[model samples]
Each structure stands twice: as C-alpha cells, then as structure tokens.
Target: MRRFFAIGLLAIHLFNIAGYSLVFQYFIYQTDTNLITKLDLNQYRESELIQFKIPISVPYIADRPDYERVDGQVEIKGVLYTYVKRKIERDTIYLQCLPNRVTQRLSKARNAYTKHVNDLPQSKKNQTGSTIKKSGIFSEYDFKTLDYQFAAPLATASTYISYLSPSPVPGALEVPGKPPENRG
Candidate 1:
C-alpha cells in the first residue's frame, strides 16, 4: 500500500510539471512578434546633418625641416652680403705654362664686358675670387660664407569629444566631484 501511495504522488507531480510546461509554451507562441520593415532613405536629407570642421593649417608632418629665409642682406661675423653691381679685372700672364695645361676664363654672362675689367667683385657663397693680393710669384684669394642651421616647428595634436549619457539610476555609484556626461 505504501509503495502504491508513493507512486501515485510521483505521477501527480509529473502531470503538474507537464501541464505547466505546455501552458508556458502556449503563452510564448500566442505572444505578438515585432514587425520588420524596410528603412526609408528619403526621410534623411543631406542639409540636416551636423557639420564638423577642423581648421589646422598644417595638414601632415613635414619630413624635411624648413628654414627662415632671410630677405635682402644677411650679415654675420662682421661681414655683410648685399646684392650690388660688382666689377672684376683680369690681366695675367702664365709664366711657366705646361704644354697640356689649359685656362678657362670667367663666363661673359656675368662678366664686366669692358676691355679694362676682368674680375667681377661679386659676393658668392662658395666662390673663390681672384687674388686679393699678389706678391712676386704667390697670390692669395678670399671666400665669403656663413654657417646656417635648418629649423622647423614641431607638430601638435589635440583632440576633444562631447559625450551624452543618460542620468544614472536614482541611487548609483559615481565618482567624487564628477557628474554624468549629460546634466542638462
């Protein structure tokens, strides 16, 4: 008798569980489903969009440095270089010339072009002008130059963002002295 009673109770529990499962499934099947619709692209217009502008003068980093161009005349080390009309005189005699040696005169493009003048007293960076002073069989010339350095400004990048977050629940953990993104 005890065995039969225990079996009857187990059957009742199984029946209840099966009936509850069927009811849950029926409720789930009877619920309404969300409808799928195609999006209407025409609703959004190009003019309604927000415009963000970045006004940085330098677009990208420069691989080669830039130098400040000194206009007019640059002066250094007690010498000044200025653009001026320069005249040079050339009158020479090769005392001991080799049979295979040759001499090239200055180009007439910048030449004084006068019968009495030969050396054009021009201030060029790397030019070694004719003898400033000649003594007997030796001569000495002068060169003008200035040491310049290249420089460029370093690029700087700064970024900022505005974020909006819904207000936190009435009672939530928050950082000290800091408010949520959207306060207004």
Candidate 2:
C-alpha cells in the first residue's frame, strides 16, 4: 500500500511540473532591441539622439496583440526633432522587409558614408554625419527572427534582448509642426 502511495505522489508531481512549464512558455515572448549611438555626438550641437522603451507588456490570458508598435521622440537641445514608430501587423506584414522611409534613409546614409570616406583624403573634411533606421525579419530553414537597428558614425552600438508581450498604445504618433509634448 505504501509503495503504491509513493508512486501515485510521484506521478502527480511530474504532471504538476509539466503543467507549469507549458504555462510559462505560453506567457513568454521576445523583443530584440538594438540602439546605435555615436561617441562624439555630443560635440556637435546640431546632432543628438534620444530613445525610449515604452511598455506594452500584458498577460496572454488578458489580451494578445496581433500588431506590435514602438514609439519614441528624438529631442535635440530640448526641442523635439521627430517622433518615430515601428508598427507591424502580423497578417499583412511580410517576413522581412524594410519600411519605405527606413530603406530610403539607410540607403542615403550608405551613399553619404561612401562620399565622405572618399572626400576626406582629397579635401579637408574632418567629420561625416550619418544616421539610419533599419528593421526586418530574418528567416532560415529552422526559424524566423525580427531585428532592427539605429546607426551613427564613430562607435559600435548596444543591443538589448527582452521577453515582453506587446500591444500598441493609441495616440502615440506625432508629426512635424504639431504641438509638442512637455518632456520637461
């Protein structure tokens, strides 16, 4: 009788552990973030980069998001220069594609980088200004990944890996000439 009781308890514990593991996996997700900053950017009054990580995390049981968005504002000398967001819809989103503006901007940066590198030796150019935003999906036979980037000249950047279930925040978009929020 005692042997049977021990085996029953062991079976129950195994089932409980497996149940907890599956529940944990259901709630977990990944947000792969990367930010690139320039080392000497502060020396240039006309240039600055500011970033924010907005929270969109929620429990899967409560709500699941089909669209994920990141919104942030860039301020230079306490003045808002631009507001940017990366909003992707799952059903309509192609696995790996750059947004129109991001593609154009990165292409422009590459062109500028090539020009500046060539011009520096021939002329007296001491500095080259470059910036880019690029994001896309990377796919292989085994897996697909979401990735993004921010770039500036003269330094390598930092990347952050997070597991945050996401949702979009309404009214997060800002346009040029619109009244700015008080960031003070």
Candidate 3:
C-alpha cells in the first residue's frame, strides 16, 4: 500500500509538470513572439484553415465584428504585419497573414515615391526656362478604373507565417518590476 501511494504521487507530480510546460510554451509563443502558431502552411494544405489563440491585448476581442473579412495590421518591433481577421471567438483571433517581405517592400516603395514626388517641384524650380513637361499619362481616376477592372481576375496572394524569437532579455515574469525588463 505504501509503494502504491508513492507511485501515485509521483505520477500526479509528473502530470502537473507536463501541464505547466504546455501552458508556459503557449504563453511564450503568443505574447513574446510574432509567431501566430507553431503550425504553418508547410504542415498543412493551403486550403485548410488553421486556427490559433491570440492574446487578449488584441483589439475587438469583446465586440466582435459582423463582417468575416476584416483587415488589420500590427507593428511588432518596428515591422508591420498585415492579416485578415477571419473569425473571432472571445480572445482567440483566427486569421491569415500576408508575407512580411511583400508588405515591407510595398511600404518602402510608397515612402520613396512620396519623397521623389515632393522633390519634383523643387528640382523644376532650379531649371529655368525648361520646356513644360506633360502630366502623367494616367490620372488618379483612371488608375481606380483600371484596378476595378483587373482586381477580380488577379489571383489572391498566399502567405506563410513567419516566426520571430523572443529577445534575450528577461521578461516581466523573470524579473518583476525591474527597470531593465524590455517592455517592447
């Protein structure tokens, strides 16, 4: 009877440790890293829907949106990530993300174009008596029309979720109330 009781206690302790480890890993991945989940397109088919739990810090957790296709972006560590909010269950947010490279490239190009356009007038001022240049061939409205015509036929972009490891610094759990803890 004594040996059986000792074995039962050990089993209970081991199960407790296993449960705590699972919860700790889940918390670390959700809050400390940019990873949506451990699962990715490589592990499943492109058409299959992958659901993951999100931290409560995410917006619209209480007031769920009526539309299924809500788009949102979050900036983590100065990098912007674009994702579509497909469904929401309490704090869990199910969504698909756009590749970081594509979004980053588009953002950079937009900034460069804006800078170039802003400087165009200054450069024109320096050139005296130069022949007047014609306006761009396509007007703003023309581009909108073109987009409407081609938007549906274009293929939807597929993306693979990328992961970023947590920083080496100690988190709040490791050092409570410490000034050196990284809040970002």
Candidate 4:
C-alpha cells in the first residue's frame, strides 16, 4: 500500500508539470501571434497609401561661415524638382499634404532661417546668394512646400527634417515602472 501511494504521488506531480508546461507554451505562442498580426496590419495600412519619393544627400561640413547646401529631387505626384549631385538616391517619402503640426514647425524654421540670413555679413551673404536662390531654402513658399533638399551642414537643419512616416522607437512601449510578472 505504501509503495503504491508513493508511486501515485510521483505520477501526479509529473502530470502537473506537463500540464503547466503546455499552458505556458500556449501563452507564449499567443503573444507572438498577436505581435505579428499587429505588425502585418500596420504594414498593410501604410502600403495602401500613396507616398512621394524624395532623394536627399546632405554633406558634412566643419565649423565655417560658409552655407552648407543640401541637394535633392523632390517628387510630388508627377512633379519633380531635380538637383545636381554626384549621385541621386531616394531617401524619404512624404504625404501629399502637410499636417497642421508640421506646418507650424515649418513656420518656425522659416523664422529661424530669416534670422540667420539677417545675421550674415554682406560678403558671406553675397557668396551664398546664388546658391540660396537656386536651393530655395529661404523662400517662404518653398519652405512650406512638402519636399526638401539634402545639403551639406545637415546638423543645423536636423529640426527641419521630416520623415514619411514616424517610426516607433524600439522598446518605447515597455513598462517603465516594473518588470513583467513572472508566472513561475
């Protein structure tokens, strides 16, 4: 009787372990499938929309008074604004219309550009005048245009840069207050 009871208890414990393992695996699989489904949905939504292809090439410049120029080809539907560069590579995409928030930001950038231009000495301004004219960085209407040029001195113009779609930063959704609950 004692031997039978011991064996029965051992068997029950083994069975419990097996059951727990199967449940845990199912939970993990469900979580993975949920994540994959969410990603697929997001991709489908983005692919269904139209986006403009804009090529941008920004040069790296050291500290200097010279205005760094960015050159790019901006494509809006069939309209194309081409620029001269060693190579043209499509870098970003934009929607047909600008968001209200983006418009506000662009206005701020325009103001900053005006201030910078006003501060420039006459000689430096003269040298950059033609490039700026050709580049159209200071044009009020041009700045409002959805497309942009890739030029040198990109660091200063980082704020003005916009992406076709805002990418979610990795690990951004993690709970900051606590680690995940351990089922074990």
Which candidate do you rate higher for lDDT, 1 or 4?
A: 4
* lDDT tens readout by residue for model 1, 1-184: 9999999999888755454444444443332111001002222233432222223344443422222221122233433322111111232111111111010112121122321133434434234644232122223344569999987866876787756667556446677885669858
Q: Least accurate stretch of 10 residues (summed lDDT) in model 4?
A: 93-102
Regarding lDDT, does 1 or 2 come out ahead? 2
- Which residues of candidate 4, in runs, are more than 4 Å off? 1-11, 43-184
Model 3: per-residue Cα lDDT over 56-163, one tens digit each: 566654645442644456666656654544666677666654434444555555444444544544334445766333244344355433434444665877788766
For model 3, the superposed segments whose C-alpha errors exceed 4 Å read 1-52, 57-67, 109-184
Clash count of each predicted structure: 6, 0, 0, 6
Q: Rank by lDDT, descending?
A: 3, 4, 2, 1
Clashing pairs in 3: none
List, residue by residue over 95-176, the lDDT tens digit for candidate 4: 2221223223333444354445446332345544542332232443644448778867655544565456444773355566
All candidates' lDDT scores? 0.33, 0.38, 0.50, 0.42
Instruction: Give lDDT: candidate 3, residue 130.
Output: 64
Ten contiguous residues minimizing lDDT sum, candidate 2: 29-38
Per-model C-alpha RMSD: 46.6, 34.5, 35.0, 33.7
TM-score-best of 3 and 4: 3
lDDT of 2 by residue, 90-136 (tens): 32221211122332344444445444533433324444643332221
TM-score of each: 0.13, 0.15, 0.25, 0.18
Against the correct fold, how does model 1 do in TM-score? 0.13
Pick the TM-score winner: 3
> Model 1 — which ten-residue stretch has the worst lDDT?
32-41
